[model samples]
Target: MKPRISMITLGVANMAKAIDFYQNGLGFPRHGEGEQVAFFNLNGSWLGLYPKDALAEDAMVDSNASGFNAFSLAHNVGSEAEVEQVIQQAINAGATVTKTPRPTDWGGYSGYFKDPDGHLWEVAHNPHFWIGPEDTPK
Candidate 1:
């Protein structure tokens, strides 16, 4: 099997709210959208949001439980502009701005935010990595 992720889908509480958070708040490009799901064009991957209960049902699990899932989705960009733009776009899209963009100790610029469903996302610029046409993750 190929070890590659073409998309990462997050189960959200409200589809419209999640859409506002990711699309209007943070400014992720909405490549495709529907009543139940929305898609964003990431640098090398795709990010998707869907109804939480539907996701749980599809996974054949109970839909009533929720707590820390222990993970966050992150985005690595090529420049400060990309990072800032994404962060601000997320904010405008209705994401609950968790942290404003700032300089990092690792010599990079980054920030964090949560979607309407409390899913965390990070936007950062790392000089050490590169995003190629093939879209492989390091």
Candidate 2:
């Protein structure tokens, strides 16, 4: 329920390649990355890269087939329990659960779902980050 976006993630095909493009080619500072995704701090939020098709699936739409799959957005909270709570809230609000909450190798707890419009959203708690209200997009 923040008034502004806390993070924005882009679904990409290749994680390493996306990382290289953002970290090297674009000179963006990446904080963490793995086989599945890559994230970069952008002002007060984040930019993420994930597999395109997988993202579509998360949104419950066929990537091979199509209509408008609205953009997936994120809202970060302060704790892991908050992540779980938000996921539940999302579900009760009519979002579909795409992935169960779990511990991640990048040292955080996270879960995924799709909004009413079928946009993918991730509720996560990254201990390494200290995203505050001051972290607003420029």
Candidate 3:
């Protein structure tokens, strides 16, 4: 099978609030119109937001389950400075800093934050890894 994720769908409790946080706070460009869902384009894939109950129904799961979802979304930048900058930006956008930017054991710098809905995100600068499209190895 091909190794690629077309989108990451976040089950948010409040659609409008989530949309505002991602669109206005983090400066993620949202496309389409409606109150039920929102879509934001990322570097290669997409970020989707939908009502938690609705998403759970679609997945045939109970929405009452909580706590860490056992996964985190990561945003990799080009340098240590960018890691700091991105983390600060997320914090300004109503994110809670779970970990302040610092040197990592992986020989890079990284940090983490929780979005308004408590979805964890990691912001990192891996000097040895080129994550962005322009620098990604062929």
Q: What tens-digit string does per-residue lDDT give for candidate 3 at 57-130? A: 99999999988789999999899999999898888888999999999998999999999999999999998885
Q: Please, what is the whole-model Cα lDDT of each candidate in the order they appear?
A: 0.80, 0.71, 0.92
Task: Sort all candidates by TM-score, best to worst.
Answer: 3, 1, 2
- The deviation in Å at residue 86 for candidate 1 is 2.1
lDDT of 2 at 91: 65
Give the poorly placed runs of model 2, Cα more than 4 Å off: 1-71, 134-138
TM values, all candidates: 0.78, 0.48, 0.96
Which stretch of 10 consecutive residues in model 2 shows the poorest summed lDDT? Answer: 65-74
TM-score attained by model 3: 0.96
- What's the CA RMSD of model 1 in angstroms? 3.1
Q: Which of the numbered candidates is closest to the native, going by highest lDDT?
A: 3
Q: Compared with the true structure, what per-residue lDDT tens digits does model 1 show for residues 1-138?
A: 968789999888778877876677666799865867888997768988878888888899888877877888888788889888887777667677778888899888889988778888888887777455665644
In TM-score terms, which candidate is top?
3
Model 2 lDDT on a 0 to 1 scale: 0.71
Supply candidate 1's per-residue lDDT for 51.
85
Candidate 3: residue 39 lDDT (0-100): 97
Query: Cα deviation in Å at residue 133, candidate 2?
Result: 1.1
